[model samples]
Target: MARVCVVGSVNMDLVFAVETLPAPGATVLASSMSRSPGGKGGNQAVAAARAGADVVLVAAVGHDDTGAALRAHLESNNVDVGGVIALPVPSGTASIVVDAQAENVIVVAPGANGHLSLSSPRLRDLVAGCEVLLMQLEIPTDTALAAARVARDAGATVLLNASPVGADPAALAQLAEVTDVVIVNESEARHWVWPVPHLVTTLGARGAVHRSAGGETRVGAPAVEAVDTTGAGDVFAGVLAAGWAADPAHAVRRACAAGALATLVPGAGDCAPDDEAIEDALN
Candidate 1:
């Protein structure tokens, strides 16, 4: 099995299920409150691990209780946490509001995730020996870029998932140059600097478009009512990385299938489906 390395954030998610999202300064009572382990980086790692891959997580958490809990969560999911760092300052957290429709609004505090620089020995070592290196924008851009450079030099397939909006176009292009695969949502597609031949744009239920030097193909999503869209993209990227690690030719197709399967469940990381479930759905 190919080894997967993820360098990103690990956060404790505080979720509130409400009837509706409040307008500016509007006071609305929520129906329920919940906590879950979620971070773009951690989510992807767990997704791949659950899909039966040798997954290693390289990220930072705070020394606070939230960080400890997040670490435990990852370990419980069978993710290799040998590269995780717990910083003494600024623990990671995400405040999420989910409406009855399962629509969510989130605000994240990078806390220790911002402190995860490429200079860390833990990150460097983990990146050195992986088949695929998965990264996201939840961490510092410099750190993300640094990891890309390292993974590229080390001859590992690098995939960049640009999320959370704001990013420099020039930097995005530069990062894409080194990435073997670039997965972006429809909204973020305009940020790419290069005319990538091997790029994927995820378009909700409409499915995804995969373009490369040879040609392009559109993978259709199965018609299914999605209870929660959270982590759907993470599942897309994670499964894609795992499949690519196994066989690059079929990565996009397999990932699109897995992403569709993820919509069958609810919540973020908790919703990611296993490989058999995805294959069953696809077949």
Candidate 2:
């Protein structure tokens, strides 16, 4: 299995179940409420591990109970949390609202996650040793760039999942230079000007598209009843990184199938499909 090291944010998600998304200047009541461990980085790490990869999360949490539980959750998922540090501030949090259709809207409060950076020599050593470096935009862009540079220098593949894609153009371009594979959704890809040779754009329900030197290939997702799409994209990125090391040709397709399976449940951390489940969905 490929060894993946993820440098990104870790947040506790406060989720609300609603019949539909609230429009602007409107108020709605939630049918139910739940909380769980989540964040783009944490979700991807769990996704990779469940997909049968050796994964480590290099991020931070607060010195609070939420942080403790989130750390424990990652360890329970077979992800290495040795690199997860503790800061004095509160743990990061994401307030998510999931509609009946499983689509969601989220707002994040980056607490200790904002403190994670490449300043720690421990992080440097961690990124250098991994076979693949996976990252997302929830953390500082400079930190992402630092990890990408270190991993690229170590001859490791760098996979960057650009979500909530609103990074500075110059900094984003620099990160793109070191990134070996770039993953984005339809909206992000539309405005993505980075000249990344290898890119994958995911279209919800419609499936995904892969663009490379060999040209573009489209893969349709498995037909599943989506319950919540909170972390489906994170699952896609993680599966792609793990599968790329073993079977690049089928990785995207395998990942798309896994993503579809993820939407069958709610919450980010628990929704990631295991190897057997992913295989079953793909078949």
Candidate 3:
């Protein structure tokens, strides 16, 4: 199995299912409400693990019960939580509203995730030893950049999922410089331009495109009814990271399928498909 290290945030997600998302200055009632373990880092780590990778997560949570549950959830999913630290503040949280169409609007409170730093020697070693380092913008950008530098220096492939993109251009640019692959959704792709070694742009339902110095490869997604699209992109990123070392083109195809399958169920990490499910989707 590929050794994948994820450096990012851990949050307890508060999800509300609504008939429609509320506009500014408008209030809407939710049809259902639930809480789950989430956060881009946590979701991707679980996705990678399910895709048959040995995944380790470097993140932070609060000393609260929510934080404990988040760590336990990752552990249950076969992710190594040795690098996860607990801080005095409350854990990060995301308030997500999912519409009937599977579209979502999210607001995040960074909490302890904002305080995540890479000052631990063990965490640095973990990042350096991985075959691929996967990251997102949920944590401190500098921390992600620092982990990327470590992984890059140690000859590991670095993949950055630039989600929730609104970081400083210079910081994002510097991150792209050391990264081997940059993953972004269609909307994010249109906004930020990076001169990275490779770029993977995910088009929901349609498929995904991989562009490198050599050329470009496009893969189509299998048709599926999406129940919730919350963690689909993270699933794509994680599965892509897991399979990228063997074949970029094939990885993109599998990642697309995994992403589509993730939407077949509700919630984030909990809904990620296993290896058999991905192959079943492909066949």
Candidate 4:
């Protein structure tokens, strides 16, 4: 099994379900509202664990009840939380709206997540010890780059998800030098930060595409009735990393299946599908 480390952001997701997404400046009533644990980092970490990876998370949450609850939740799910730190700020949060068709819009407030700096020696050392390092744009760019450099130096394969967009060039270039794989969606693929040769692009209902030095392979997603589109990408990343060490080809297919299953539920992180669920979906 591969040892995976995820260093990124953690947040509480406040979600509203609606019949249709409102146009900009349009006020509409929500069908329902709920809360869940989320954040690209948190989602990927939990997803990897559920996908059967030995996972550790390096992140910071606010020193509040929400943070504590989240920590306990991840711990219960079998992710090592020793790398998670508590900072003196409000926990990060995301306000999300999902429509009847499961399309979503989100706004994030990075509170304690902003306090996670690149200076943590512990973080670098942790990355060095892992077989894989998974990261995202939810954290500071410099920190994500630093972790990648350390993990690469220690011979760990680095997988970066170019998401939540808007990454600056310098960080993107540095990451390209160290990253083994870059995962993105169609829109994100257009904005490739680094010229990484290895790439995975998720194409919604069309499935996902993986490109490498040899050629490209496309895997079809399992058909499912989507309840919420949130966290589908995260599930794909997690499943990809989890199966990568043992079987790259099968992993990609499993990843697509897991992502499809994720859409059958709402929220992220804590909602990742289990192995049994993934296998069932594939059947």
Candidate 5:
């Protein structure tokens, strides 16, 4: 299996299901509420593991029950948690509101995620030995970039998913310099001009487009009714990272299928499809 290292955040998601999202300064009641393990880093780690990759996640969590549960959840999903550290802070939390259309609005409290640092030798070694280093913006941008630099120097492929947009342009540009492929949603794609070797823009149900020095290619997604769009983008990025080194186009197709499948279920990490399920979707 491909070995993928993820340097990002981990959070416990508090989800509320509502008929419609609240408008600005408006109050709304949710029909139901639940909690789940999520975070761009954790979600992508689980997604890659399910897609048959050896995954290691480098992140931090609070020294609390929520953090313990989050770590256990990742372990249950087959992700190596050796690099996960517990700190004297509250674990990260994301309050998500999902509407009937599977669209969502999320607010995150960084908590311990804000304290993640890549200063440890063990963590640096972990980052330097992976086949692919996957990252997101939920954590400190400087930390993510530092990990990317270490991975890039060790001949590893770097994949950055610049989500939740709003990253410092100068820092993002520096990250792009060391990244092999940069994945983003349509909106995020327009947020910055990436200087990476490959840029992949995910188009939701329409699929994704990949551009590189060689040229550009587009792939279509399988049709499916979305139950909840949460973590679908993470699924795409993780699945893509799992197979990208072998075949870029095929990886995009698989990632598209896996992402579409993710919407059939609610929540994030638990919804990722395994290799067989993804192949079945493709067939």
Candidate 6:
């Protein structure tokens, strides 16, 4: 197995369940309210760890009780929290609304996450030690770029998940120069052309489309029933990283199967399936 480093965000998700979303200023009663451990970085790290990757999580959380609980949760799941910095202000929190159909709306207040930064020494160390460096936009752009550069320089494969939203074209291209594989959905792919030929575009139920490194071959998603599509992309990235680390030639198909299997469950990181489960699906 390869060592994987995840640089991203961590937050306590306060969720409200309702029949449907309400328009501005319109009042609607929520059927239930709950809290869950979430954030793009944490979710992806958890997904990768659960998928059998040796994972280290680099992130930030506030000094509040929620932050403490989040750290405990990550530790319990066997994710390395050595990179997480706990601060006194702006505790991490997100407001999420999920409808009966499992559709979701989220608002994030970065809080302590805004204070997170990765030093050059730390970056170099992590890049040197890990086989794969996975990142997201939830952290500072410069920090994420720095980590990618170091990982690329250190000869570790770099995978960037362009999620939560799109990126500027110039920045995206620059990032691609240091990136080994780029994973995005159809909408994300449309934002900028990738310089790296090993790109994968995830298309919901229709499956995902993959362009190989040589840029001559392609692959598509396997058959599966999707329930809640929340963390499918993260699961895809995690499984893909695992496959690439173990056997680069077989990564794409195995990754697609794990991602599709994740869709059968609900929630983000919580939805990622074990290796055997995904392999069984692939078989």
Q: Between candidates 2 and 5, name the one with more favorable lDDT.
A: 5
The ten-residue window of minimal lDDT in model 3 covers: 263-272
Clashes in model 6: which pairs? Answer: none
Candidate 2 residue pairs that clash: none
TM-score of each: 0.94, 0.98, 0.99, 0.97, 0.99, 0.89
For candidate 6, write residues 1-283 as lDDT tens digits.
6799888888887878788888889888888887878887887788778778899888888878888988998897789988887888866788877677666777888887777777646645865678899888777777778888888878899988876565566777788888887888888887777778587887765667778755544455666655556667777887777667778556777677777877777566477888788778777
Please, what are the lDDT tens digits per residue for candidate 1 over residues 22-72?
A: 999999898788888888999899888877789999999887888888888
Indicate whether candidate 3 or candidate 6 has the larger TM-score: 3
Global lDDT of model 5: 0.94
lDDT of each: 0.82, 0.91, 0.94, 0.87, 0.94, 0.77
Q: Which runs of model 3 end up more than 4 angstroms from their true locations? A: none
Q: After superposition, how far is residue 276 of candidate 3 from its true place, in Å?
A: 0.5
Model 2: how far residue 209 lies from native, Å: 0.5
Give me the displacement of residue 193 in model 4, in angstroms: 5.8
Clash pairs, candidate 4, are none
Report each candidate's C-alpha RMSD, comma-separated, in the order given: 1.7, 0.8, 0.7, 1.2, 0.7, 2.3
Colliding pairs, model 1: 197-212
Model 6 TM:
0.89
Residue 130, model 4, lDDT? 94
Over the stretch 61-135, how does candidate 5's per-residue lDDT look in tens digits? Answer: 999999999999999999999999999999999999999999999999999989999989999999998999999
Shift of residue 142 alpha carbon in model 4, Å: 0.1
How many clashes show up in model 2? 0
lDDT of 2 at 279: 89
